[model samples]
Target: MSMPPVKKIVTWLLVIFLLYAIFTSPSDAANIVGSAWDVIANGVANIGRFFDSLIARS
Candidate 1:
C-alpha cells in the first residue's frame, strides 16, 4: 500500500520475470540486452555530436 512497499514489490516482480525469461528464452534476453545497449550507445553518440557542434560554434 505504501510507496516503499509498492516499489519493492515491483522490483521483485521484475526480477522474477527476468529470471523466468532467462531460463526460458535466453537468446531472446540476450537480443534484448544487445538492442538496449545499441540504443544507449546511439543516444550517447548523439549527445556527443550535439556538444561537438556547440563547441565548434564557440
Candidate 2:
C-alpha cells in the first residue's frame, strides 16, 4: 500500500527540519534527543510498574 501524499510531505518536512536542527546546533539536538529518551524511558518504566501492580494483585 502507498502512503498518502500529505503524509509523505509531512514526513519529508520533519526529516528536513531534523537534519537542519542537527547540523545547525548539534549540542541542542543532542539535548533534545536525551530529553526525549528520558521521557520515553520513564513512560516505559511507569507502564512496567502498572503491569507489575496488576500481576501482584492477582
Candidate 3:
C-alpha cells in the first residue's frame, strides 16, 4: 500500500520480465544489445571526427 513497497514490487516484476525475455528469446536480446552497442560506437566515432576536424582547423 505504501510507495516504497509499490516501487519494490514494480522493480521485481521488471526483473522477472527481463529474465523471461532473456531465457525465452535470447537471440532477440542479443540483437537488442548489438544494436545498442552499434549506436554507442557510432556516437563515439562521430565525436572523434569532430575533434579531428577541430584540430585540423588550428
Better model by lDDT: candidate 2 vs candidate 3: 2
lDDT of 2 by residue, 1-58 (tens): 9999999999999999999999999999999999999999999999999999999999
How does each model score on TM-score? 0.89, 0.85, 0.73
lDDT of 3 by residue, 4-46 (tens): 9889899999999999999999999999989999999999999
Clash number for each model: 0, 0, 0
On a 0 to 100 scale, what is the lDDT of residue 55 in model 1? 100
Against the reference, the lDDT scores of all candidates come to: 0.97, 1.00, 0.96
Residues 1-58, model 1: lDDT tens digits: 4579889999999999999999999999999999999999999999999999999999
- Ranked candidates (TM-score, high to low): 1, 2, 3
Q: List the residue pairs that clash in candidate 1.
A: none
- Cα RMSD (Å) per model? 2.4, 1.2, 3.5
User: Highest lDDT: which candidate?
Assistant: 2
Model 2 bad stretches (over 4 Å)? none
